[model samples]
Target: MIVRGVRGATTVKANQEKEILDATEGLMRTICEENEIDPENVAQVILTVTEDLTATFPAKALRRLAGWTHVPVMCAQEIPVPNGLEKCIRVMITLNTTKAQSEIHHVYLNEAVKLRPDLQLTKDS
Candidate 1:
């Protein structure tokens, strides 16, 4: 088996706990779904939100939503660039997979796509 990193990001409507948790859950679910990941094969998940968002730990939301009680999940602040995506939440997950790196799918939803124009080849939601 090989290890690969999957990246996914999305924006929050506000810093409220409910909003943050909802956005985080949505992104995490999408990543798992798009990549066909099995929870047992997931090594760990590192989630970061823009410095402006701090209502709650994004990783906690991931754990709760995915029932990942035993997975190693961490939360941190993303580098605060002056003009960075506002209220953005991002995650990089290391997973055990038989697939190659080039086969992994990375998702950037909503306006977060602006962060990666080269991957904007798809119009599907």
Candidate 2:
């Protein structure tokens, strides 16, 4: 199997802990569902949040998901760029898969759709 990266991002209305955790969970689930990823196949998950979101570590959301407890997850601060999007949570999952890189669907939900307008996928997509 080859290693592929699934990318996803979502925006939170506020920096509250619940909002951050919920947004992170939603983004992670969509990425996994879109890519048909199994937790065992996931090598690592990296979650990053914009400077404005600090109420909690987004990685905590993953641990709450069934079968994700064993998955290695990390959380970090996103680069504080000038005029950058705020209250944003981004995730990149590295997983072993038989599919080609092009087959991997990158999810961009909520206000994060602006980050990758080409994706054209939202909460329902």
Candidate 3:
């Protein structure tokens, strides 16, 4: 199996811990399901959030809520550009899989969806 990374991002209404964690967890689940991921095969996961998000780190929530204890996860701060996506949590999960790049799916959810209209899962949006 070759290792590939799944990219996903989601934005919350505010910097609250609960909202941030929930949105992040949802985005991760969606990406995992779409890519047929096996947690055991996951090499590592890196998460980033805009500087405005100070309530909590999405990576910590993933370990707690998703039971990714065996998987190595890290967190960082995203560049805080003016007028950037607020409370956004971004994830890059490197996992071992047989799928090719063409078959891999990336996700952008919530208001973050507006960041990449071309990549949205459906045209009906």
Candidate 4:
């Protein structure tokens, strides 16, 4: 199997610990579901949050999921760009899979939909 990267991002409603964890979990779960990814197949997960969000580490959310305890996860602060999105959390999931790069779907939710309008998906779609 080849290694593939699945990207996703979402904006939280606020800089609260619960909001960060919930948003992170929601984004990660959607990415995994859309890509048919198994936690065991995930090699690593890198999570980043905007500088304005410092309430908690988003990686903590993943560890609470079943089968994700052993997965390697890291969290970092995104660069405080002058005009970048705020209260946004981004994720990159590296996993072993047979799917091609073109088959991987990147998810952007909430206000993060503006980040990559070309790849946007909707419940209706």
Best by lDDT: 4
TM-score of each: 0.91, 0.94, 0.90, 0.94
- Give the Cα RMSD of candidate 3: 2.2
Model 3 lowest lDDT segment of ten: 116-125
Using lDDT as the measure, name the better of candidate 2 and candidate 3: 2
**TM accuracy, model 1:** 0.91
- Candidate 2 lDDT over residue span 1-125, tens digit each: 99888888999988799988888888888888888889999999999989888799999999889899898899999999999888888998999999997788999988888888776455533
The whole-model lDDT of each prediction reads 0.82, 0.87, 0.82, 0.88
List runs of model 1 lying over 4 Å from the truth: 120-125
Q: Can you write out model 3's per-residue Cα lDDT over 1-125, one digit (the tens) per residue? A: 89898888888888898988888788888888888787888999999998989898788777764558889899999988888887788899998899998888888887777777887462111
Residue ranges of candidate 2 with Cα displaced over 4 Å: 120-125
User: Once model 4 is optimally superposed onto the true structure by TM-score, how far is the C-alpha of residue 9 displaced, in angstroms?
Assistant: 0.2
In angstroms, the error of model 3 at 86 is 1.5
Clashes of each: 0, 0, 0, 0
Q: Give the TM-score of candidate 2.
A: 0.94
Ten-residue stretch with the least lDDT total in model 1: 116-125
Candidate 4 residue 7 Cα shift, in angstroms, is 0.2
Residue 111, model 4: Cα distance from true site in angstroms:
0.3
Model 4: clashing residue pairs? none
lDDT-best of 3 and 4: 4
RMSD of each: 1.8, 1.4, 2.2, 1.9
Model 1, residue 83: distance off in Å is 0.8
